[model samples]
Target: MNRRDPRVVRRLSSLRRRRLAFVVRETAARVTRILLIALGVLILLAGAVLTPLPGHVGLPLLVLGLMVVLRNSFQARRRFIRWQKRHPKLIFPIRRLMRREPEILLVAWQQLLRSEKVVLRRPGWRVLKRGRKAVRKALGKTPLS
Candidate 1:
């Protein structure tokens, strides 16, 4: 539906592909970090129980594990900031889109509801209610108090 120049379309598509790849890489890095941390803990426990292995080995493993965790945390934070900058929609596009196609409002709602950041058993209800209210206000509806 976007009748833009071919070059523009190509650029946009490439950017989207790159962003998706980055997200996948970020997720993989996080998984690797968790596994490394777990392995480090296990190594530490083994070092404690088994007197044969030098304490130095376990200390290095723990240090490496902490480094991996820190690296992943830093990368994730940077990626989040980059994503926010590159995809402003992730933060504020709902209001703009709601003005154009009110019917697609439910799509946005569904996205927020199904977000991984929303812990379903915890404060999810509160977040959902707040999201709904925000969306409703964006759509120019009289929001429920």
Candidate 2:
């Protein structure tokens, strides 16, 4: 545990060695950050263009773009946090997608079931009511509630 020990001295000497000048390191980091922001913007634009086309393609691209932008840009992160605070409900789905293990299928199924419930509220829609009941049960909810 001595500061002047031979082993400690070698570690400290290695720590002081610089592989690159400070300015080079800073410039490289800035360039990389700019490239990432540009790439994120491009992805976002692509997502917007593809959104109107069909299937479940564009949403993932949009989420991926948002994640890249948020990761690389401090301003974007600040704005996202502010928006998230102001509109938790609107931001919830994107936040879910940004998770390490996003439950895409489950989220889609839940949304589908919710929309079905909203659309088929009449008593005559017995088939969907049964489906709703099954979904509720599978999700650990009581059917009556």
Candidate 3:
């Protein structure tokens, strides 16, 4: 209980020490994220540079950079997911190839079937498509297709 006691000083300093530790942790996390993002960008640039050099490291470096960036970044992950959803036919095959699986063949076949265009008789098809676009334009709506 005496002011001169070491235990008293330690007890008084504990709250300030915890606050300092919390601030350090938060600052460290921000710095780590920045570093990771920078590292990922540098790696991607390296991969791009390697692409025309006739080596096998380019694609692997690219994937590694992508993984690191995505793992560290919520914004990048969201954007990537949106892009993937918009282009599954393109994304699916790449995903399969990355996994070293032959399932991409099946995915290609599925996409081929799904993409088979039908130009035949639907009397109002043009009217519907055009009308939808016109109405969407009038309403200022985003295009889904």
**Please, what is the whole-model Cα lDDT of each candidate in the order they appear?**
0.60, 0.84, 0.74
Question: Per-residue lDDT for 145 in model 2?
Answer: 56
lDDT computed for candidate 3: 0.74
**Using lDDT as the measure, which candidate wins?**
2
The alpha-carbon lDDT assigned to residue 7 of candidate 2 equals: 95
In model 1, the clashing pairs are none
lDDT of 1 at 92: 43
- Residue 19 Cα positional deviation in candidate 1, in Å, after optimal superposition: 0.6
Off by over 4 Å in 3: 1-12, 93-145
Clash count, predicted structure 3: 0
Q: Rank the candidates by TM-score, best first.
A: 2, 3, 1
What is candidate 1's lDDT per residue for 1-145, written digit by digit as tens? 4649888899899999999999999999878877865675565465455545655454334334433443446664476467758887563443333243443456546566657345665664567767778889899999655
Q: 1-145 in candidate 2: lDDT tens per residue?
A: 7998999998877766553466679899999999999999999999988999988778888999999999999999999999999998678778888999998977776667667767888756746567778889899987665
Candidate 2 ranges with C-alpha deviation above 4 Å: 1-20, 113-130, 134-145
lDDT for 52 (candidate 2):
92
How do the residues 1-145 of candidate 3 rate in per-residue lDDT, one tens digit apiece?
Answer: 6988999899879978999999999999999998998899899889888867886688667766877788788998898789899998666655664564446456555554444424524545544456657999999998888
RMSD of 1: 22.4
Cα TM-score of candidate 2:
0.71
